[model samples]
Target: MERPRRGWEIPGDHVVCMYKIIVTPNASVRGVASKVIRYASIGEKEARQKQEYERFNAEIISWYETSKRVGLVMISYPPEMFDAKYGGIASLLSVIAGWNVSMNEILRVKLLDVFLPEKITKEFEGPRWSPDKIRRKLRTGGEQNCFLRVPIYPRLAYPEDYEHRIKCLLKKAPEIAPDIIADSELLFNHEFCSIDKRIDIMSKFNKHVESMMDAKERVETKTGCKTLFFINVSGKPSYTLEKTEAVKEAGLDGITLNVLTTGFSLLEDLRSKFKNLIIYARANAHALLTRGNSVGISFDVLAKLFKIAGADIIYTGAPCGSLDRVKPLDDHVADIRHRNTIVRNPIYNIEPALPSISGGVHLGNLQVNILLAGVPLQITVGDGIYNFPWARNNLDRIADVIRLFKKAIYIITQRKENMWDDHEFRELRHKKCRTYFMEEGKCVDPTDKEIKDVLRRWVYPEFRDVLEKWERGK
Candidate 1:
């Protein structure tokens, strides 16, 4: 008797009715354990099951020729498997990376990427605020097209202290005005500094900054740019919604969510509800899934998913500085490129999200970061700004460090010639390269002579030639 046909075998014009996944199959075996049957009459049932498995293996599994066991495979699933309407990112994730159940046949698998049809793409609202719109809204112009963001950790005494800290930074060097000031992911709703208090303090501070900029009288206030405050709204669904409501009510600029922890569904919900608020999606926790060589999902896939879930800005790990210790520079660069492509590339008519580089980024390697990105970026500094060598002695010098970064970025971006060869670039680097030395952990302030020695011995030698090569190619 003829065996029952598999989905792929019985398919006719299933292009729109299918979603595809590329996975590296480390092991492929029968999902069900074989059982010994006592009766000979039941042999036909087992024979039919065996035939079904063979048909699936032959027709559906498109394996790539490789030396490894089982090899890589591309699997396609019928649209019926997904609930495109009711089921959101969770369901899509299950369809793509749920190897434990739906993909149980593959004992070990690494999900590389996923391609959803237009029908699936149309179901979700992508980023409401594209990077271009954000730039226009902030009235960012000239050589300073890329955004400078500073993150405030939760070491402050109270929510008001956070406001005071930001005010102090801007007051010291108004030119150091960042486009976006965000609360660290570690800053949650503590008893002393609740989300409400933080929002109230920051919203008022934002207004004050706007007023100062509008007046354009005080040289200390003449930043010629607007600052946006993005509070961390990552929490349970109910708490997130409540905090989002407070943010909107207080007329705050934006909210950030740890997408990996809170899940992508919350991101979509926030986008749908608060169409105007900029949603920054943090995927720092993704290292658990993406760090492996031959398991879990790829950063490329996660980047795409973040964009699809309506994140205006996504924090992709930095390619240079501190994160290098965790992974090779090449790997980090590859991940950043993937994220940049996903955010910048026009696909399915969805608005693009802004790719942000954060960990261990500073003025020294800032030019290198921009060159590698080859696109507009949100260059975020944490300890890079807060713990600068000059700032260690006097917090006011933090502004000077920011000013130095602005000068360097302007020279690098605006100049037509190679930045590395430019006199101004070299001068700026020599004067301020020491700022990059003060990262998250290493807080010890080095002497100016020590700084010069370190730069000459390590930083300049390591990055100079590389930056020159990159600049020439660009």
Candidate 2:
């Protein structure tokens, strides 16, 4: 048997990186990664912490079966999926999903004013989902999206509060591994970066980071389960490579990385160097858009392009996790992970994709998210895991979420029997966002030329000088 090895690399103009996803027998233990990870009792605690996760699991299953509710569906396009909150247009959705209001009783609004891509608009050509369509889609699983988000802000506790809070954060990894580890500050403007530069937070920050890293090590050491861990280096790119190395050193099984946080040259350099890190291009490409929703590359196109550029994975979106873009989300994920058909065997691994089902993931939505993903999915969770009320700590909830999530991933990955009847299964798979084909021709997939333009025309040319300096160690 070949021992699986993972690495990253850049092939000339293309940033090419590859890593394997293992489905090992011992992989199910929540924190005990006895094989791929080993670290000191870096942070003291027996491998027994995973036992507490039993509590984490129970609370979550209870929530899902009980209080979870349907939230509103916001509809507004925003550039940069990783940046600021999408349009303030989420009131309806917030009221619905956050508040759990039913859609049928709500009033519907028809509009005459409009702005949309010509190609896309032509398909709908002046159509919006009538309430009936929306209801049908929702009921039929044709369209429904939800999200659970955890924004990894810097340790916000006051200097006095830091120790205990940090300890709490570190100690609970097993009980509360989240769906989406923002692994980064969800929102940081240029001003914050400048502030980081002026202050000496770098060293102190690492100490905090190390504590979390140590916690991760303990979890992997004990439970052996590897849930998605989004490590956002965008917070500090200079430290990113090293931090990523630390993550691997700590024995983390997977990570989420953002291409926007660092220059292409830096990413190229990372690909060439570590090769072990599984890079997930974060956010919408920063170079590509503005308030004008027109003229933008689709996340699907970007994922494929980045894969070609050496990214091994991409977070496409949840079933419209935050805003209800299920139809489109479904299409994007399918387009990315068509998997190995008997005939294709290996279909170029085009986007080298992981349609990371992310967005607002929470306790209430776990099973629904499982159903939405249809199997073989990476369910990224965040707030749902961290924000648990202490008596009912969120960590246990996270454990349960992962258990359910992995159950889905495992079954799908194994080609298990479809538990849903054909009619129900087809209905779930037939999400509406994927139906954008007005022209009778099979739509052509994205071309790498557009990616090249973004790279060469927008980012690389400016990035060359710094890269050269870094390469030469000047």
Candidate 3:
């Protein structure tokens, strides 16, 4: 009769949102119990009564201190606090990232993970094109046939330069065809080379590549697969929408979005607008949000969010690449595995996103990447392909590098031989040539002793033949 005490009113059958957060207690705060405070609106008497009716109040599900300063807590909130359907990702972050008034006492907060209920997970139309569907469409058969992606880089000042590169790459498409060719994130719309001009050039080459593949299909079973060309479409909402419309009209394969730069909501809107176009989410600026230990969200958590936002391919940094310089070997590997697992694992009705291992992948380290990330993955090489000494002087050699990359993947995945014990393989392994990228220290030459060592090892006997034939320019 008191009008439910203004803001303290409780509704029947209210859904609860669950979250796992890591918090660093302020110097004044004492004990773990002090870290787990309930929402101010939820009175003890009302909470107890709601529990009896199968409805729950905002409360700490679990809590434990990992260190003197840091503590891990699992908390639940009433529907009044957050609603996935109406709130979306922004509101979800506001709650877990400690923007709530109840979290004012905490010094530092890091969102480790979130366990959303089915009702919530279903609201997000996860990835429209699952990794398996992508593979099938690309004609990439078998688990061993990993998807390869290369980028157009070094900054094209003019549209003609961009067209020239595409022509060169497509001319050698039959020799070593890659699954995807994307524009760099830095390569955005400009007066000198606008998105429309780039899309026009790519659309023209797309037809040529398709024809080349069609001709090769007569002899090679999987050789005729259509290569997806993804243009960088990250910009202002209106501009991005405009560029995407052009890409769709041009019938281009896909478009890339810098998720961290453009925001998750943009990715979701694009997926909703374009049902079939592949969305490659690039989190190049993730380190600013995920590099800290006691602050910011974890990479795994961000990766899951990207998947939920309908990213068909998410860039999970490669363990053997530049990520090793920033993150520990173990952490990098764990991040890669976690991203790979969540995208493919069944969750409500969400489709799986393809985990991309990029950031310095080359033929030298290609085998280690395949070993680390496993099957149904995308390996993207930018500097690895474009910076190759041979390819720098001659565009034809770009196809040769791709051929070597394909052979390396095949040998790693299909061959059953134990090359680790062979003397030449062991020497090559010791040189770290099979792990480090070109820019990390030294550039790997086809004539390098380490490469010759791999050949001499004859570990995957068939690889030796491929290398010899490639050397002969056959």
Candidate ordering by TM-score (highest first): 3, 1, 2
lDDT of 2 by residue, 1-474 (tens): 332221122122211111111122333221221211111111123323655422111100000111112111112221221111222212211221221111222221111111122221111111121223222321212222221223343423233332333233334443333323334434332443432221223234434544665665633322122223434455466666666665566544234556655554445455556554556556545334311222222343334334434454445554424632434443433432332111111123222234455566643344334443443344555444454332134432434434433333332223332222224323322442124222222121112342222222222232344223322421
Tell me model 1's lDDT, rounded to 2 decimals.
0.63
- In the range 11-121, model 3's lDDT, one tens digit per residue, is 332322222334344443234333343333344456556766334345565565555655566555554555566566766666555434246555666666655555556
Q: Which runs of model 3 end up more than 4 angstroms from their true locations?
A: 1-56, 78-81, 101-104, 141-144, 214-224, 415-474
| TM-score of each prediction | 0.77, 0.39, 0.79
Instruction: List candidate 2 stretches off by more than 4 Å.
Output: 1-182, 185-230, 235-256, 284-294, 323-351, 387-474
List per-candidate RMSD values in Å. 8.7, 28.1, 9.1
Model 3 scores worst on lDDT over the 10 consecutive residues at: 1-10
RMSD of 1: 8.7
Q: Which residue pairs collide, candidate 3? A: none
Q: How accurate locally, in lDDT, is each candidate?
A: 0.63, 0.33, 0.65
lDDT of 1 by residue, 240-297 (tens): 9999999998887899899999988888889999998999988867878877666677
> Model 2 has how many clashing residue pairs?
45
Better of 1 and 3 by lDDT: 3
